[model samples]
Target chain A: MEPGMISLAGGNPDLAGLPLDALGDAASALIREHGTEVLQYSTGAGIDELRTELTRVMARAGIEADPADLLVTAGSQMALELITAMYCDPGDVVLAEGPSYVGAISTFMGLEAEVSHVPCDADGIVPDALEARIAELRAAGKRVKLLYTIPNFNNPSGITLAADRRPRIAEICREAGIVLVEDDPYGLVRFEGETVPAIRAADPSVIYLGSLSKIFSPGIRIGWVLAPREVRDRLQLLSESTTIHASTLSQHLALTYLRDFDWSGHLDRAIVRYRERAEALLEALPSALPAGSTWTRPSGGFFVWATLPEGASADELFALAAEEGVVFIPGSGFYADGQGERELRFSFSLESPERIREGMTRLARASERYARR
Target chain B: MEPGMISLAGGNPDLAGLPLDALGDAASALIREHGTEVLQYSTGAGIDELRTELTRVMARAGIEADPADLLVTAGSQMALELITAMYCDPGDVVLAEGPSYVGAISTFMGLEAEVSHVPCDADGIVPDALEARIAELRAAGKRVKLLYTIPNFNNPSGITLAADRRPRIAEICREAGIVLVEDDPYGLVRFEGETVPAIRAADPSVIYLGSLSKIFSPGIRIGWVLAPREVRDRLQLLSESTTIHASTLSQHLALTYLRDFDWSGHLDRAIVRYRERAEALLEALPSALPAGSTWTRPSGGFFVWATLPEGASADELFALAAEEGVVFIPGSGFYADGQGERELRFSFSLESPERIREGMTRLARASERYARR
Candidate 1:
């Protein structure tokens, strides 16, 4: 991006809110105190202390997980990749929410799995739509093997699956014999509303992916997968066969932060900052967006899913926005098929409230020029 | 392992040799001074500074690499997986040394690729054997896609590919249209002889995998792949789609170590320690084995490959050895086909010379019991 550009593109959390000094001290103490453990090769299943601690981390979301059934990963992305690799044979179908996490879509495609979209509404993946998509794919001779969802606030769209629908979605997948993969990176970064029990809480068989990236640090690249014994065994084997294990130092750092620091307090302050940024962006959208444009009002999470006026290309708008010193991700890349061309995502996670307002002003000017074009 | 068990199984480096106090200070300062850069999600291609620094690391082995063509991975293991995933379709053939790295063999099989072994002798994979295997596989209608090798002191076998044979091996793979992947984690861990030129140095097209695990620390989980441009681009995409990136803190730690620390000096001391351990194992081997047993004398790297008496089962010996309070990896796990039942790998990397000597004595006792049985 150019120097003058105001990027509403990145989905990265604000690291400025992290307690760097405390974290640094913890990192130093960890390596100094336990150099052998921290700097040596660890088990493929991950460090036992972290795995046990992660059960406590999951308990916050009402998900009961056994340490034995948990595998530490490089991040939640690795967890998703492993699950997709295990379940999907070439040409096998993976059902995902329309406007699903792009990384998941890419992973499935990269592994040669066919990703089919299950239409989602403001409240997140619609159960009826999911069932219909699965049936349609199966009727068409596609083997639907897995359903990937973000039960908490999702990437790009920032739509959280309604609490009432969680168990229903899990049951539907269970009946279909489809493995439900729940990626809940943003589960703890809520701005409003009560904590929705994770889909994994309702279904013991769900392959739950949890990450420290949002709550703690992505730099450590620590995440965990909670799954049934059979699935966990295979994932563990895959993890062992490939990367061997996640970074030992990274796992240790995460364990230290979780054990010694008031991570909850840090998360609370971050949520407040994000809430202010979101409010600033939402407040400006009315004057900034073009006529007939619409967008999701995210209660919690990093992004606002916005739709362009009908027949308008968000790709073109992106170019125009860049010219006006504002930028965002065009939505076409998020879809399995060439859908969502008239949509885009604005992230309110990285910038301050003032910068967000300034970005909105630039976006309004860009929209005006785009309307003329 | 049991408390009394003397394990010669682990291939981990000695972390006690590392300057923990200095490393801890550096790690602390890294996050404190550059928290945003160190703690946030980074590019899948890896940080530019580290990529640039890795070129210098490769230069030690006479391999010239461009930073643009280099990718930072979780370890060489991840690099191997990405390459395999890209090149091998299900049922596609991958050729490896008869007794290859167990991790690589497992990775190939896990990705649904068919692994075929090319026989190897003291000087590493025989060129004629490799040629014969490729011809035989091609005639059998197999789609051979990749040739995986460790041209340095190979894992388990501890056999380095003769410097003269390196170019010939590259040529053979090139002619067969197979991508040659060189995993050289121990290229710099030589105890004797001049540093051999890497196969990548002889053939720029060879996809070279380098790791800091052996020389620095596996706990940090840093490795790099220097590949051709097209391959690197796809790898970068696959990396971005899956794990997103290597750990940012890990990457920064690696960069800091390379830039500021006396890493080469540390490696020299480590090599001296490993040499002493290797000597202890080699010196004790004659009395430690069955009458007709044979083993390789490694000039560098971790393991000493040994063959038991004719028709003796290494797995059964493993059981007996465990009863004698000693452990080693049976060679069957390192082979694609079940051909190494009489062989085993004794790793001298982790234990001290005195412990190695004691481990050898216990192994001798185990062999006697196995012979009696």
Candidate 2:
């Protein structure tokens, strides 16, 4: 795609928001200081410095975790894969939000786990729906291994679970004896509202995933998992047999970047920039949509989920929009049974406010063309 | 683990022999030219430039792989794990060399594959013994999904498959309709003698693993898998659900490093350095070993495999050696049946000649203590 092409297909950070200069500085410093060790086989868990720093980051986020409980992975995708391998046997049921991260859905499927979608509204997965599904599966003699959630700023849907729901869900998971997988790659990208307590704080049984991809850069591929000791140990064993460890150079560079750079300041700047873009898209939605169409207003994260009027398919709209030099991910791709035919996900992270407005104008034209037909 | 500690446990490239200065130059140029793309998610397969370069590297090693048939992974470990997931279901039998890379063994076990060991002699897996085992398993109505081998300078054993035996093994696997997984991490590390053609070259059914870890650096964690188109496609699907892809920064850095740096010259220098250390260990072994004990004289690679006399356990020896600040991996850890009681693996990659001699002296002391007990 061209530079002017406004794309909502990628789950990428704003390129203009990346601290490119800091990354260059960190890379240079890492090679100069730890070149010998950076080029060698590191500990199977990850570099100690990165893990330690990650532990501190999690603590500040109200998730009390020891560095020992963290396993720095290639990305949150690997973290999910490792957890899936450890907990899910073939045919085991994994309950997840109706519209979840496509990558996580595929990972569970690849392991032969039966992924059952739990219904969600604007506030993420409904607790009653989750409980009903679990009870239904249990009564049928099916084993539900994990309850996967993107509690804060969920992907594709861009919905965050209400603060009151966190404890209720945690309690239900505890009662059901199922692990809760809290994937929060975009938790730090808050644009408004007070910070809610993570699911991990509501219960120790939650497996929390954190990533540098959203706040820093995705190219480094650095992510971490915070779980209970048993899960951490099992994941470490699996990691030893997987990639052995995350890249030592990447880990070291991340450590240097975190240590020498003002990460919180960077994140604050990113949130402000993203919030402005998100607001611009929201403001343009009325003129860009059909009379009965609707869209989500997410408090944080990269995506804005939209649902078209009846009889309008987002998949068809995506093709039409592409013809106008724009791209988007059809929301059906994020659903388990491909049921979100009328919905679409638009990423506001990559493009600026001006481009997002233009992209929406193009999308509006395409939608009108399809609606007229 | 001091700076000058005679570290014989590391599976790393010789840092002194690494083209560090050239890598620095490449890093600067890479940032100046393609900083933006390098710090972005390129593709799940890999950067195109690196894949093309790897194809040439594989071709030179006698494995004619099309770039399309390859998927760059986080490391050789990831390649093995992904391939295992693709071919073997839970409880399926996977035939592996008797004393294999522990990491690969663990990966197969983690996937719940029933791993059975095929007996091997000094020159690697004995073809007759392998055939006999296959026949016995077949008669019992058991299916062998794949046979995994390190045909060139096998880890832990430091034994290469004899040239004549390679084709025979490949033919047997082909006829038996079992996949041959040719893991050649040490292929280019040959310090002496002619390089044997990879088993993959002789059998199109064989899946090949190539790594930049041994020859270039391990910290980058970049490796490639050359499999049949079907298998490669499956791995791509699998990778999409796992780490997404290897680090883009690492891939870009590697491409630049490979293109601009004199990797062949660096490898030559590494071989000479490691050979000197290997020779020093060999010269000291006679004095260090007890009567009836022997060690393999490896032509290349990081390790030297030693066998104590019958009734002498390597685990017991390792315990004593650890107290004296010397460590070696017990051979039993590499065996499927945990039967290598008298064997041990010593690495020569990390130590200098003088350090190797000193570590050998410490090991001798530990051996004497074990023998007396």
Q: Please name the candidate that would achieve the greatest TM-score relative to the true structure.
A: 1
Write down the C-alpha DockQ for each prediction: 0.84, 0.65
State the fnat of model 1.
0.86
Tell me the number of clashing residue pairs for each predicted model.
0, 0
lDDT accuracy of residue B73 in candidate 1: 91
Pick the lDDT winner.
1
CA displacement after TM-score superposition, residue B28 of candidate 1 (Å) = 0.3
C-alpha displacement of A184 in model 2, angstroms? 0.3
Alpha-carbon shift of residue B30 in model 2 (angstroms):
3.3
Off by over 4 Å in 2: A2-4, B1-7, B28-33
Q: Write the per-residue lDDT of candidate 1 for residues B253-290, one digit (tens) a residue.
A: 89988999999999999999999999999999899888
Q: Score chain B of candidate 2 by TM-score.
A: 0.96
Task: Say which docking band candidate 1 falls in.
Answer: high
Best by DockQ: 1
